[model samples]
Target: MKKQFAIIGMGRFGSSICRELFHMGHEVIAIDTDEKKLSLARSFTTETFVGNGTDESFLEKIGIRNFDHVIVAIGDDIQASILTTLHVKDQNVPNVWVKAQNDYHHKVLDKIGADRIFHPEKEMGSRIAAYLTSDTVLDYIDLSADYSIIEMLATKKVAGKTLIELDPRKRYGCTVIAVKQKHQVDVTPDPAEPIKEGDILILIGDKRDLRRFREGELS
Candidate 1:
């Protein structure tokens, strides 16, 4: 289903969201104080506005309440970012997501009822650090402080073994949610399905359990 999205900044992050959503056949309205930045978004979205996003009147004029999702991706000026998120939330946009600059920014966005808050830099940094530091972990997703999802390459130790034989859930308290080999992906793969040497196993579990499981794989 197509969704309508309003992005309140034309910076790298906001522009990326606008471009992707528009390319995916969603209605994307891009706004920025910089006319030049807004102009860059024109090819991706038909609706481009130059205005102060912090102003409730400007938001109202743009029909922000009509949007299914609104993203406040202001990179700098934490005050403007907070105020714009406040105005968007006040307008009662159903899904309001914000790019938080810091922990302080994240807390403020949460206080103002942002549906989701993301630290894109921190997230990417963590994922990259994981990949760089671990041979088995190809990707990592932080679900919470304790829980995570990890994509691990099936090494020689586990190659050609079935999931039931591995019994990750019983032995390590992790669940293999999916397996991908080349272009093909299997979700909730059968216990009898054999894992290939290069297959990527997607597992979800507590972070501690994941570390232990990975350590065992290394040993």
Candidate 2:
């Protein structure tokens, strides 16, 4: 299903979100105070608005409450970000996500009822650290503090081995949730299926166990 997303900021982070959501076939409204930024976002968003998001009058006029999700991505302006988030929540938007510049900003957003808070730089740093750990790790998503889902490309160490032989769950405390071979995806692959070189594996496990598996076995 498609969603209506309003992104209030046109910085790098906000623009990226707008572009991705638009590409995913969702309705995206990009808002920013800078006309230049809005011009850039116009190509990627369903609509682009040049205005200060902190202005409640403007927000109300634009019918912000109708959006399924509203993202407060005001860059550097902490006060504006908080005010925008508060106003958006007051309008009863179903989901309100905010980008925080620091831990303090995160705490403030938490107190103000942001459904999700993202620390882009910090999160990306952790992801890059994971990539540096092993070439097999293609992508990472944190499910929680202790759990994660990782996309890994099968290498010589893992190729030609069946799940029963590898015994990931018993040996590494991880489970291969899905496997992608070429254009096909096998969500419920047989345990006896042989993993081929260059196949993508979607694995979920405790972070510590995943780290140990990547460093000790896959590396």
Candidate 3:
């Protein structure tokens, strides 16, 4: 399903998101005070606006309230970012996601009713570090401080073995939630199913237990 998004900045991070979302077939409106910065997004969509996103009237004029989700990707200016997010929420947009500049900025966004907050740089750094350290890990996500989910390429070590035989839950203290073989994904795979040599296993567990699984099973 397609979604309507109002992106309030056109700097590197914001433009990147606009391009990805456009390619993903979402209706995106890009806004920035700088025409040059905003122009970077025009190739993606014609719904580019030149205005102060912090101004409630400007946001109202753009029909921001009607969008399914609004992203306040403002750069550097913490005050401007906070005010823009607050105004977007005030307009009653159902999902308001913001890029947090720092801890302080994140706290303010949290207090102001921003539905979701993220640190892109910090997240990307952790993901890259995981890839660098592991040869089999294809992706990683931190669900919380103690829990994580990871995707690992299935290797010969586990080939032809059934889930019950491998007994990940009992042995590794992790769960095999899904397996991706090429384009097809098997969610909650049957325990009797045999593991293939090149499938991808998606597992979830406590972070320390996941690490133990990596060292004990996926080594």
Query: If scored against the real structure, what TM-score would every candidate get?
Result: 0.60, 0.61, 0.61
List pairs with backbone clashes in candidate 1: none
- Pairs that collide, model 2: none
Task: Enumerate clash totals for all models, in the order shown.
Answer: 0, 0, 0
Question: What would the per-residue lDDT of candidate 2 be over residues 69-168, giving only the tens digit for each residue?
Answer: 8878889999999999999999999889888999999999999999978887855534533543356988899887679999888888888888899887
**Quick one: ranking by TM-score, best first?**
2, 3, 1
Expressed as tens digits, the lDDT of each residue in 1-219 for candidate 3 is 456778888887777677767764667789999999877678886499999988999889988899877778888999999999888888998888888999999999999999878687865434533543456889899888678899998888889988899788999899989999999999978889899988899999986687677767776
lDDT against the true structure, each candidate: 0.82, 0.83, 0.81
Model 1, runs deviating above 4 Å: 123-188, 191-219
How do the residues 1-219 of candidate 1 rate in per-residue lDDT, one tens digit apiece?
Answer: 456778888998788777757765677789999999988889999699999988899899988899878888898899999999988888988888888999999998899898878787765534533443456888899898679899998898888889888888999999999999899888968889888898999999997788677767633
Candidate 3: residue 118 lDDT (0-100): 69
lDDT of 2: 0.83
Error of 3 at 4 (Å): 1.0
